[model samples]
Target: MAETGAPRRQSLGFLLLYALAWAGGAMAYVPFLTILLPARMTALVGVSDVEYLGYVTFCGAVAASLAGIAFGWLSDVTRNRRGWIAAGLVLTILLLLAVPLAKDVWTLIGIILLWQLALNMVLSPLAAWAGDCVPDEQKGLLGGLIALSPALGAWSGAIATTPGLVSVDGRLAVVAGLVLLAVTPVLLFGRPRPFPELTAPPPVCADGDVAARPRGPAVRMWLARLLVQIAEAALFAYLYFWFRSIDPAMQDNEKARLFSVALTLAVPVALLAGRWADRRDRPFLPLVIGASVSAMGLVGMALAGDAGMAKASYLIFGIATTVFLSLHSGQTLRILPRSDRRGRDLGVFNLTNTVPSLIMPWLTISLVPGFGFETLFLLLAALAAGAVLLLATLPRGR
Candidate 1:
């Protein structure tokens, strides 16, 4: 992508606001999908709850994918990032409020489809807004800051599900309120640059030069991300089951705590790694290292015969995966081909996030059920290694 010129460096305040906005976008869905929605599923269909939840999740992912692209393209067409983000925030909150009204599975699924669409409305423009405002020199640090999104998302989920704190509808309201509180500041007081016209020239790098990133590197980055994402998705879906196989005494909350620990610890890791990338002007290097380490963690998991060993290995994989994802989100903006289409292209890149959900289930079913989790972990390690290879193949540049 050709930038208009070198990028305009944003202040620390703007970057934090931008990161919080992205975190808010993540908060919009993570809780509902992880805690609240599953609770609703259990209430509605006790025996086959997960089956129905999977259907809802699959449908929601589809809606999110389409909506991400559509809203991003619309923002590009309208050159109104804040407007789209605001509209999306309102719609998402409304949909969250509507969740309590659905008593049936299909009804809840329908509401979730709408919710996913609305959530992406906020996310797509918000992501593209970073490209518009944040300079390449700071993008790595931006990724580090963006890592707070998932930690906060998990924390929000903890609040929503805290015992005796709230009822089902109450949880939905709390989530909506939290979203509103977190997102409004960015919309009302923040001063991010407006999205430029569709014909805007290529994006500028931070060092007073037009970015020279080509489609080829971006394409490789996309594939590499997809491969690592597959591994992450697999572990997310099956960590509990795999742990249970190691020790039948392990409880769900144990794994829950593990998940929280992984996400929380990864935030600082992402921050440190991002800052290092910024200082070094080598964005892909962290990704390559993260992927390689993640592969090693997977292999460790594959060989772990004890619960303690498994948890330790999973922690390694989890931290590396989370850091990789956070950094990739920021760096993707750097490599994306055009300023005009950054949002739309980011939407395309988001497929790496959703497509893995579709693929991981079938892959896990095919492997874990028959060959056992050892086989599954090994295969996931292969995918992580493949990510490392793809990232390694990228021509060395910032």
Candidate 2:
């Protein structure tokens, strides 16, 4: 894809407001997925937490993966990214509101599956919209801004799970309100720039064509993200359960606070990393450094023996993962080889996101029960290492 001339830089107000909207949407549902749903599953299912979580997450992942692809492709065809986002957000809010009515384990799982599909409908297009509107030079700034999402999501979880606020209906109402509030800025004041009109379609290169060379780094980027995503999914999906196992006295709010702290710490780091990349015009360097640091954190987690040690390791891992992911998200916009099919391509790239959730559940089931969490951490560390290796293969100035 040909790089455009220096486009006008977006105003700081616009970026900040847009970022807030993004973070707000994340806040609405992430708490439910990460903290509340697991607890509900544990209560409903008679089986072990690990077993039930594995099944539920796998099913949700399947729906999310399919919906991301389908909706993303639809956005490309209709050129109606905003409409998809709005509809998805509305549907997701309705589904989340109805979650309190799931009286049984199977019903809860069904709702979660539907929720996942709806959320992906919003998420995939939101992602593609960024690629479509934001200029290349500004992607790093955008990445820094996007780093706020996880922190907000964690804080939202804390609010939702606080004592007296833990009921499904209560949490759902608050979260849905926040989602609407968060997206309002983008919807009302900061409308996304329309994508350029579609011109003649680019010819697809056949196998053995010289045009395929440009895709090599893109492929490596995809693999690198997949590995990091796997490492992240493992910790994110099971962190609450793991913390409780380590310290039975630990409260959900405390765990959520710790997550918030870790992500909050990463916010400035992401801004700095993104700014550095923008100034130097070298995004890949930050990605490599971030990956290597994450591997170290996973190794630390594997070696921990007690709750205190585990918390420290998680802090390290959390901070590193946010930086890696934020930078990776920004750089993705830069490396994608095709501009015409940006949404579809990003949907395929998003397999790295949803696919990891699918596999992590199975990985945990296989390793955590039989081999222990230590073994699982070690395996995740290996995956992070693989990410580092793959990322190192990209040529400079990528």
Superposed model 1: Cα runs more than 4 Å off: 1-8, 193-199, 202-213, 237-256, 303-306
**Tens-place lDDT digits, model 1, residues 1-398:** 23468554567777788778888876777677656776688788886765675577578778888988899889988889999999999999999999889988889889988888889999999988888877777888999998888777767777776667887579889888888888888888887554344246766778987764468988898999999988887775456456767998965345556777787899999999999998888888999999998999999999998888888998898888889999999888878887877789989998898788777777776776579889988998999998888887675556
Q: Quote the lDDT for 317 in model 2.
A: 90
RMSD of each: 4.6, 3.1
> Alpha-carbon error at 97 in model 2, in Å?
0.8
What TM-score does candidate 2 get on C-alpha atoms? 0.92
Q: Whole-model lDDT for model 2 versus the true structure?
A: 0.82
TM-score of each: 0.88, 0.92
The true-versus-predicted C-alpha distance at residue 280 of model 2, in Å, is 0.4
Instruction: Assess the local accuracy of residue 338 in candidate 2 as a C-alpha lDDT between 0 and 100.
Output: 67
lDDT of each: 0.81, 0.82
Model 2 lDDT tens row, 16-61: 8778877876786568877877777777775576687788888988
